[model samples]
Target chain A: MDIPRHWRLRKQRYGLVGEVCESCNAKVFPPRDICPECGKEAKTLYTFSGHGEVYSYTTVFDAPAGFDETAPYTVAMIKLDEGPLVTAQLTDLENRKVEIGMPVEMVTRKLRNATDERGLLVYGYKFRPVMN
Target chain B: MTEKIELLKPQRPVGIVGYGAYVPRYRLPAKEISRIWTEGQGGLPVTEKSVPGPDEDVATMSIEAARNALKRAGIHAHQLRAVWVGSESHPYAVKPTSTIVAEAIGAVPNTQAADWEFACKAGTEAMVAAMGMVGSKMADYTLAIGMDTAQGRPGDPLEYTAAAGGAAFIIGPAENSVAEIEASYSFVTDTPDFFRRAYQKYPEHGHRFTGEPAYFKHITAAGETMLKATGTTPEDYAYAVFHQPNAKFPQNVASALGFTREQIKTGLLVPMIGNTYSGAAIIGLTAILDVAKPGDKILMVSYGSGAGSDAMVLKVTELIDERRDKAITTIAYVERRTEIDYAEYVRMRGKLTMK
Candidate 1:
């Protein structure tokens, strides 16, 4: 990752900052220049409430490059309170405890370290169970 | 005439609008460390210590604590005029944890954010700065946080006590607060009982030297000074929370200062959670606030390794009764725990050298 890419993704990574569709009033994440639902320009920025529920999940036991350190982790499709589903890793929970419909909230965290020496550290948002 | 060390009382009383603490659900038993090292021979200082997952750090934990603070405060994030984070383990060596926390909580653009470091007392340092800002009307509300995913070297004594957790406090006007800050005092010295040099990951300590001259001396001086300045004794306070590096330190200090174990037990979480470093005292204070009734007076003193102590007195208000239910209490977080074995603890902390 280059500096510009890191800079551009900061808002999304930091707060799950996204955009709302003006025409259909749809909430979209991984923010796009155009709304996926209405196929129209989305200039208005939308900040997510960070409240969501697990829609689906899988535990990865197999190791992948750079992710080998954290193998056997749980990744999930979270259905935001708004009308969007986000895919991210689940944290602050045991793999066995994760289930569909479990409430969660977004938290900013280290996504991954730099692959090479002298590389920038990458940070982003992940979800954890919303503790009462 | 000599300049006196006046108790720090805001010109306009500022109170805690909201407060929250977060201890990661993952726990590493002290016995597990002993089992691996001393073969379970020596008694452990703490029962267990909290561990941050691969994704959690000071920033993430601070965000959670800040969110809870916002919830109880019942104020829009935009209404915050300042956010200050104090931590020794700030994830990024170059980046500001406060800005990320401010932006994550939606307080960006309208707030002044900065990071602070004063060893373990960093949290209280932020609180003092926030009190000054809010009390002087420079800011309507300020958020002060102390959090850490503290680190320890493998097999080091520090490993047994260095732990993960944090707490956040919202400071605003007395009218909207759950508890009012009556007065505060700080006592610091050039003692070097503990330190982690630049580029070093683990900290070294003076062992027995850290006791009498560092933790004990500073805490007692601050506590006594605050008591004298406020014209009160230990018996006057309903609860007392001292910086807990381990179970014994706070208990010993409290007893010497004429406070009963009963008065200190409510805020003593270091036995179960280890020392949260910057989060230690504030987390203890938050735990006390969880059960304190209106009109209860609390005395808190925090110690740092460098070393110094920040002492303060707080009085619970009627507002505390109504707002206690606004967010989850500290006990709620403490009660939710899942113990992990030694292997998993090492893995979670990334202690194993990668091949």
Candidate 2:
């Protein structure tokens, strides 16, 4: 939530900009410097295509601290088209209607508020169902 | 030569190369808002309005609409020379919404970006500037957008009508355009029909004053001026789109200007989605463009409550049919909606206070 932390993670927060393993052709999100698949250093930065499908999901009935305003939200694990499974909250859909394999696309959104403390707004990526 | 209207004709013929609109899927019925207050006596003036999710704002909506515009333009985002966003509800107070949009659309590093404000007509204001930039050969393509996740103070009349949505247009030469701009004109006056001072969360308006002397006066003046300047009559236009603050104003204004119900009905969305503030007129224009055939002409007038109106004459081209299907149309967005009750609407819009 501090300035440095926010600045350092911008690439990952925006566009899901990460790294793809050159040696093993594996995709890593929130990108890792060292590829887990081949134990080699990631040399190339890959921006995600942002098209994906819901792989798994659960409705959070119990609100977490600082998230009481948006309780009972559905969070999902999305399998990106480029081969990375990302955990994100499902947006613009009914909690009861969230199903596995629903098509979605990434969008920038306000993640949380630091209103009580530093008055900082944490913005990042969230996924919404792709409109026809 | 004597001129009656100061028509804005870019140095060269500029037209809409591409266009797109985005209305969030979530809808909040006016009755739901009225339900929360419980003290209001009458039925809701508008049926329902679109609401932005907790994560969404003008910046996010503009990015989505701009992406759609780029898709229809069939050009790389890098090829865009300018990105302009006009909105009253820009997310950050100090930061420029255009920069965020420009970076999101990949038009950064060399493109011009700015945020504009003229109330509801802000989007059209940006469009006229974009046309000038492209027509002057200063840029090959310019992206202009009007978007807002507008806010309405609780228990206020504006709350039932202020809504969320956006539309984007790519301006370029007429040679590759889908809708050619024949001519445009602007009218302004020292009318204080609606306004929001600095740091005010919601806007204020002069109840009856916003009607005849503000919305009607500006819209009629600009509408008549554009028509006369273009040497066209109301009968010559296939459709006319007026800035819709609510369902009643556009209908009344259009009728007073000699346009029939059928002529304005196609672009009348305020009854369904409330007023998107800056996005109101441009989104309506996008709807008309979706159904209009090649060679159809449209009269569009946008009113902002400072107040002023920007009027334009546009002629559709054969290229419209080819590009219309390339992206999702306005009707699709309007139809793909889900209704939410007052509680959910409040939560989604982040109206609740958190500790």
Candidate 3:
């Protein structure tokens, strides 16, 4: 079975972050290779807090070619506390229960572990709902 | 000895003279893909394929197409006076990709060559530009090529079809051409069916919105415009080549447009080759050129997600028949596929690792 290429990290910091450019308040995540706003293109370590409101999402009935085992997984775009919305999988919930604007928290866990093209183990984080 | 003082621009009928295709030797087996995505034991009905190699890029693909076009046009690249390449995913964001292609293909120095990017329709648009230029007698011959390396987000449903490929055509005087451009029609609207933000890594789709509004609407509009302009029905042409976003969308759109399923099968390469982005319908155009008999009128319609469409009518000439007998055709190219398993697909597609 296929897994993410970066699924080897032993420590899982389950959350999402984007850059709120100090040069120009633009919230970005996964870290921008360059800044579209303010031309800051500067790589500032802008830390983003999760606990986002779901904007939209899908039950993902058709998981990608390699994500069969993780079938019926829910992927969504959640507007974060930092202003930018991101797409991530919702966990600890059923497909029917996933609703728009549903408050959720970011949690990092083993999405999938597998050998990469270069043949190395990889790991990454996904998201889930947090009940207040 | 000075050239004659030509007050009015001469009109030269430039059209496609030769065509060729190159499908990668590697294929990713659908069962293997299903093994990872489905039950891990061949759970799907279809297998996706990909070209496995690093050096292969939009530039390389264009070269292959140009080489074939030159061979079919029966002229060395040096004999060509103009060249144009249309692609959205050029190797460099700033560099003119046409230079690399022109150099590799030996287009003569001081030739008019550049790239075009109007979403997926850039390739055909290049054809339009070349035809206008050559038709006005600005140049004697020109080569137009369409190529792409489609990108999709990791784990996105689109990953199933973002494959890379290319196609090329040489346009010269119609009397010496392999296909005559019978008619051309286009449609554009302020619609956003699909879009990818810069540095966002993958495209953002509007889901069902893409089906009715941007994709199907524009294709139908353009195809109808061409049919009406040319005064013909679906039964007039032997085949129809469409810009294929998926295997299913083509069928749905064709049924609605009055073209039968048999007519639509000529250029539906998305299911097997994935979405070649700009190369989709144009490659289908080349595939048709490979199989079409002389005098076959193939109706071509291209759709780009940002709500634009171009419909063109091409009548195959005997020149392509001779080339078809000696060179590659769509069927032979389709047969040379080697299937890749789903795990490997993830790696090749950048969705998974080999770790």
Candidate 4:
């Protein structure tokens, strides 16, 4: 990933910041300016509570480039408490099985190592089993 | 006339308004480490050590802890005037971990950010600076974090104990504090006990030299100084915590300082979580605060290689009980763990590079 591109998405990547539509009262993730519900401009920033449950999940044995080191990792579609489904990698699994409705919480983590040894480290949010 | 070196106190009394600790969920048991290297024949230093997942690092863990601190402090991130991270294993060599933390917590733009290093005591160094900032009223609140994903040579003695985890404390005025800082003392000297040159993958210690002349000397001096200057004895403190590189070091040090096992038990977590380096002492303090009652006096001491110690006396306030449950407790992080084998540990720690 390029530095500027990653930098641009920092708010979303770091804090789960997204848009909330006033017209339809919908929460939009990935922060699209236009609301999917009302087709209106939904630019008000809202930080997710980072609490969610696994809507669906898959364990990736064959990892993508820049992620081979962490192969056999699980990626899940999380249904946020606020009614948005976001795709993220589930971490801190500790060998436990991931169920469809397991509760999880957001945590900041290294998304991947730098593009190269001299490149920048990419960090983002991942979900883990909630402690409580 | 003789010069006097007195314990340092904030002008207006500053204390930990909120505090949080993070221990990675993964555990690499000592026997697992021994199984690989020592054929499971050696006496282990600790029962287990916390291991950062492939994705976790100092910056990420620090952010988690800081968020917890913010949540417990009941304040907006923007209200923070500074964010200082103390660590030896900052993911980036040149970039500042403090900025990443500040930005993640939404404290950027208006926050003074920097990183501090003093070996293991790096966290308390930041804590001392935070005291100064909040004490002088230069900042209403400041965040100081001590976190690390410390590494050791593949088969070195340090490997068994070098671990991942840390704690964050929000320093503010006494009125809002959960624990009021009464006084602090620092003892430092030029000593070459441990070093990891720039770009080095693992740190090298001076074998037994790390003890006696380094950890013991500095910690004892700072501990005794803080006690004498405050006109308090070890018996006065309800609890005491020390920088724990392993279970033995803190136990030994506590005994030497006149603190009994009962006084040190609540804060001695290294046996279960390994040595979190910069996070060692502060995380222990967090654990102590987890169950401490109002009016409970606590003593804390942290030692860093190359070499120094920071000691402080804190008195738990009425706010402790009300605020402590606001965030995850240290014991919860400790219990919410899973055991990993040596092979998984190597994979998570990135000890084996993929071509």
Candidate 5:
């Protein structure tokens, strides 16, 4: 499987960028087309520090049928200092310590690919611990 | 010295000019229902309740009630001033069911709207809030609705009573009203009789704890407080509407408070439609509004199992004759209903699902 276009784009940038509205000063992780607060069509470019803390998380035991090979994975909502919540997965702390308020940073990792050696490609964002 | 009334009434008079109700087109018998449910029996509360078809959700059920209400009122959706839907089991937690129903039923120009939730009493509570808005002159006419396709952990006694249905009322002042808001009151208590966690779909409840603290105590407290506020006795009411969770409980509470059978036909909906959660009390109110004559007095009680109760008194106006066909008559709400087995019930309740 080949990587999806979005995955390629994410791979191209080691760091993901977000946007903050000039009118309301509200930060958007996914980079909204317009400001949710002021409805302004204008947005200012900003790179995340890639640092955040876990607000809530859950480990998925029941995945889609073919994804069984990837037995367990963590999905979480992270609160960034920039002031927006982003939905991502926790990594690096896989076999170690991970808590509600654990500090994390963004990392480009291979999520379960829908296709194996001779298959179709699917990928998403995951997170790992920050190096102090 | 007289008490000052701070709440001023709205300008345009609102009334339910149109109404429609849909029960899933299937029926189940008591014996068939009993074979699966361990709790059901023959003697006291004998009738089996109606169930929803697979395609119906809280959204669809509420639309059916709204259609009937709008039809009876003989008014277009453009006439509405605001819309409110009461439900604990909303389709999407963040997205409002009021918008969906409003758009579908034609309340438009981006009207003042929201979804209200407080448990089984949610629908009537929506009714009360809409009354406040119209009474406060915020809106000329408003839609107050209650609906639920509630879930129960399979095999629990609440499973039988947990059912699908909805009721909608348009609130305005009394000039041409079918039912005028005479007085409304509510009593609240911090009783934790039943609750469902956010992560959990089915609810966990203290079976008997719901009876005393949540059901009897709160409802009775509100009932008496309302009666006292109105300075009347049970006999003064031509009808009494209670949040009916089952065939027996509401009656037990009513009889304990001196209400006779003649005073509560609306309360009998549970024996047929099951426990509609937010829809229970409002569904009963719809029925009472159907048959009420001019000058008839009615009392309504709403309870949410966390828990709390709101009691209200309504006076039938001469306009009762104008929109007599607007409500989901008891027969139509029951007759059109479809029935499902324990397994299907489990599927709808989401106790069992296909991956």
Candidate 6:
């Protein structure tokens, strides 16, 4: 990923910052300016609690370009406590079986080593099983 | 007339307003490392070491710890005046990890940020500076973090103990502090105990030279100086924590300084989590603070390989009990472990070269 693109998404990537629709009281992730729920302007910034559960998940054996090193990792659709589903890679599995409703929490992590070894280290949020 | 060098104290009292520790959930057992290299020949330095994930680095881990510290501090990120990260394993050579940390924690635009290095004591070095910033009223609060995703040569003895994890501390006025910093002393000298050059992938050490003349000398000097300057004896402290390169170093140093096994056991986490380099001493201090009570006096000493030591005395305040449970405890991170074999460890650590 390029520097400007990464820089623009930092707030969303780092702290799960998204938009909340005032008209409909809906939380919008990936921060679209227009709210899908109410078709209104949703510009207020809201930081997610980062607490969620695995709504669904899958194991990827065949990796994508930048994520080859961490192939065979788990990716999940997380249902945030405040009502938004976001896709993320699950980490620190510690060999525990990921269930449909297993609780997880957000953590900052290197999303990938971008461009090349010397280029940029793109960091963002990744989720892990909540420590009990 | 004789000149006197006094220990560092903030002009006004400053204390740890909030603190947090982060240990990556992956574990690489010593025996697994031994199986590949030593064939189980020598005694393992530690039971296992914490390993960062393929996606984790110093910046990521520091942000996690700093968030936890912010959670416990009950303070807004914008209120912070500085964020200083101390580590040897910052991912980027030219870029500053402190900025990334500060931005992630939402302390940017108004905060003074930088990175500090003094080998393993890098974290404590930041802590000392934070005390100065807050104590001198230059800043109302400053965040100092000591953390590392330390690497070791594939088969070197350092491999068994050089590990991942760290802790973060927020220094603020005594009124909001959980533990008040009474005084701090630093002892430093020119010594070549360990080095990893500008482009070196792995660090080189002077073998046994790292022990007596480097680690012991500086730690003892700093420890004794702090003790004498405070007019307190070892018995005065409820607990003592020293820089743990491995389990033995802190134990041996604690014994030599007249602190008993019981006094240092709570903070001796290296036996399980390995040495977190810059995070070593401060992480141990976090564990001590986890269970420390009101009015409990604690002694902490951190040693770096350059070499030098920073010794500090802290008195736990009544607010400790109310604040400690606000975030995840150090023991919880230690216990939340996933054991991985050598092949997995190699893959995660990127030890194997690939085209």
- Which interface RMSD values do the candidates have, in the order shown? 2.6, 2.5, 21.9, 2.0, 22.9, 2.3
At residue A79, candidate 5 shows an lDDT of: 89
lDDT tens digits by residue: candidate 4, B276-302: 999999999999999999999999999
* lDDT sort, best first: 4, 6, 1, 2, 5, 3
TM-score of each: 0.94, 0.92, 0.67, 0.97, 0.68, 0.97
Clashing pairs in 2: none
Q: For candidate 3 chain B, which ten residues in a row score worst on lDDT?
A: B2-11
For model 3, what is the error of residue A54's alpha carbon versus the real structure, in angstroms, after optimal superposition?
60
Question: What would the per-residue lDDT of candidate 6 be over residues B1-355, giving only the tens digit for each residue?
Answer: 9657699988899999999999998899999999999888889889999998888889999998999898888999998999999999988888899999998888888999999999999999999999999988999999999999997999999999989999999999989999999999999999999999998889999999999999999999999889988999999999999999988888999989999999999999998999999999999999999999999999999999989999999999998998999999999999978889999988788877775
Model 5 agreement with the true structure over B265-307: per-residue lDDT tens digits? 6556777767778888877877777777889988888889888
The window of 10 residues in a row where model 5 chain B has the poorest summed lDDT is B4-13
- What residue runs in model 1 are displaced by over 4 Å at the alpha carbon? A22-24, A33-35, A39-41, A95-97, A113-118, B1-4
Q: Which 10-residue window of candidate 6 chain B scores lowest in summed lDDT?
A: B346-355
Per-residue C-alpha lDDT of model 1 across residues B1-355, encoded as one tens digit per residue: 9667699899899999999898888888899998888999887889999888776779878988998899888998899999999999987778799988887788989789999998898999999888899899998899999998888888888788889997999999988999999888989899999898988878888989989999999999999999988889988999999999988989999999999999999999998888999999999999999899999999999988898999989999998877777777887877778899989888778776765
For model 4, the superposed segments whose C-alpha errors exceed 4 Å read A113-116
Superposing every Cα of model 4 onto the true structure, what RMSD results? 1.4
Residues forming the 10-long window of minimal summed lDDT in candidate 4 chain B: B346-355
Pick by lDDT: 1 or 4, better one:
4
Among all windows of 10 consecutive residues in model 4 chain A, the one with the lowest summed lDDT is A112-121
User: DockQ: which is higher, 1 or 5?
Assistant: 1
DockQ metric for all predictions: 0.53, 0.44, 0.01, 0.64, 0.01, 0.63
**Which lDDT tens digits does candidate 1 get at residues A71-118?**
677889999999789999887777458879999988777776322334
Mind giving the per-residue lDDT tens digits that candidate 2 earns over B231-347?
Answer: 788999899999998888899898888999999988888889989989999999999999999999999999998989999899999999889888889889887778988888766
* DockQ, Cα level, model 2: 0.44
